[model samples]
Target: MRECDPRIVLGLHRSRYERRILTSALDLGVDAIDTSFNYHGFSAHTALATAGSDLLPRFKISTKVGFFPTAGQAEHSLDPDRLREAVERSIRDLGRAPDLVFLHNPERSLTGSSAAAQDRLGMACAAVERAAAEGLCGGWGISSWDPRPLPRLVDGTLPRPDAVMVRAGLLAGIDVLEASEALAARWDLNPSQLWGMSPFGGSATQPLWGKLDPRVFIQSPHDGLSAVQATFRVAYWLPRVGRISVGTDSPTHLGELVDALRYEANLDNLSTYRRLLCEQRDRQPL
Candidate 1:
């Protein structure tokens, strides 16, 4: 799966290209198409909704929140009213409701004291409930880059959605896979339900950029090629992880990405790890 911003087309002027991309993407035969609540001034959303309709019989649509920078400020609060407004706007923007509406940072709702946490949890739950009521999403879920509160949420202490989208990959070392496995076993959830992100992190640029330094979350010494392979391999085997979405902001990377996925599908664990290690080791100066 891939998460792309239709707005990356610049403005309404380049809409023709965006439209073509959307049309092409619909027929790309991918298993899913993901849109974001903050994608391309709502036009992309609308375009995707329409394009998705054409491929509805073949693909799943996953939409998310949690990076809406309003006036250059990052917004992470899961306020019910805010979330409802977002959904409504997204529906209007996309011209239809998505198959799934994921609360971008449900964990953000727990950043305060107990009372504040409760309030945030309530708001998040309300958001899901409202989405369900509106028939906006097939099911609701939470997307958390942070795992601090995930175990609790999935353990049933917190509100549970039909799924949980997480950030899992090599940058997290083995813990990435371990945490996911633990969650599945603990909650008895399927393996494919886990959604992974940032498999390469910085490993998307150069020899020392997107490389396999799993210990560095914010930096990568590997290239995007290595990152792509590593991520796809883990997600493929991570049991309940239904989809693996990579956040590649540039269109230039799309072609290489598609090729990588094609090659990735045929790779085994040993091959994947060897490639990651080779990239990492290569990054080390002789």
Candidate 2:
């Protein structure tokens, strides 16, 4: 087996939940995977258990809660009791507790006045925190697709997460990047305590990847790197997270991502790019 690489997390949000990919991840040294309670029609945990009950123990699994099934449609909720129940159910479905459990886009359910929003977010975080304390899961985190609403809501009183996962990549934009950093700082989290998700903003096949030369973000002699691979490498520095969760069912593609890590990032280019992003974009495009 290949030695485990701590940096790459196989995000199962878009996965087919196949056994071969799980085996491939282990063989490729990608020993971590991130999923959500609501993924794959809320059958993700069960499917994972079914596909590779034995393999689950080989990987460090991270998953999200807060979204639940309702009347055949998924709905977001921050109710403490409901959140705790989700954690319990996830353990039952997966046949094991996840290594880390994220609050899962808490922003989606945070609405109303600022004070009210803060209260809701804090209680939800506490519920997961309690689950972790009770051994319902190994640890707790907050995975935010859009982290803008979070930094402001975070303060000393809020229950800090073991880590915070946010969007990272050329497409992450300046606003979310800064917000993720700010939130981590408020919680006194170091880089290793921060994580990145959706490095390609959900897909590597998007038209945008083909148009840009992402190698600019990497220190040269990297002419051999593919633009897609270059983008994955640069994602590590985009928001400066320790681990990044990306998805793919193909083992070859997964290997390509692991190989991209050999190239070092061009911090100067990344800095300049961030400056330009700050100058032009104050908000993410709708």
Candidate 3:
């Protein structure tokens, strides 16, 4: 894979500030934009369509398939026909084919027997492959909320991803960092091929920087950096993380993140912080 600048992928969730956030991200030189077919009941893609016509060629675009949000709840089904419809709808809604299309969250679709789960996954993967071949998408991947299927992917039991998005962060409480490292090694994949989402654990509810203990930063070499900056550095500095996706509606907040990326983290200090975070997690009760 060709190496590029460390990427900041803007995540477009269901927010009223979609246009503003997308515009700000483009101005700040974000390498990619991630959205879903069902985000804001498909309004997210429409927003991108309006703003991204001139900008789409400048960045990689990724979206998810297999789920559609409704008034009451999301309709989830990974039947091949549904998957194809979803991808086609996304392409139409976004006004361009996605560079990468992902299976929204296959784990949720898995139930009952392991054999049944495998069959479902195979069908989904096949649908994604067909989409890629048909020019609906450049490639296919998985955005897994659950890591259980990752090992199968790594070991060749499941389909390999052109890109994999998983939750990872500076906090040791997040297990995907380790899993990502191992999977990358097994597949000989570059960091760019492994996109790390939620660098600050769960950006939606509790921002990681706010939850971090103040004492963790004490005795650190990167002392001048704020907790948020330090957190971004740690995630950015990870060897196997090619891109970090952050979601925020404020242009000022986006600018702050862009500025933070300019500073490099001290390796030794980063290691120590990881150790401290692990210890903190251990101290918590199960």
Number of the top lDDT candidate = 2
RMSD of 1: 8.2
Rank list by lDDT: 2, 3, 1
- 1 or 2, greater by lDDT: 2
Relative to the true structure, candidate 1 reaches a TM of 0.66
Among all candidates shown, the one with the greatest TM-score: 2
Instruction: Give the total clashing residue pairs for model 2.
Output: 0
Task: Give lDDT tens digits, candidate 1, residues 1-286.
Answer: 3554221111121233244454444333344556566555435566655644554445456677654557755666676777777777776766556677788766765865666665667567767767876697777776666655555444454555676666654454444455556655555666556666554444455564444542222123234544544444444443336555664434445444454443333235435664676577668898
**How does residue 242 of candidate 3 score in lDDT?**
70
Candidate lDDT scores, in order, read: 0.55, 0.92, 0.71
Model 2 residue 222 CA deviation (Å) reads 0.7
Q: Model 2, stretches more than 4 Å misplaced?
A: 282-286
Compared with the true structure, model 3 gives a TM-score of 0.82
Question: For model 2, how does the per-residue alpha-carbon lDDT over 31-149 read when each residue is reduced to its tens digit?
Answer: 99899899999999999999999999998999999898999999999999999998989999999999999999999988898899999999999999999999999999998889998
Point out the higher-scoring one by TM-score: 2 or 3: 2
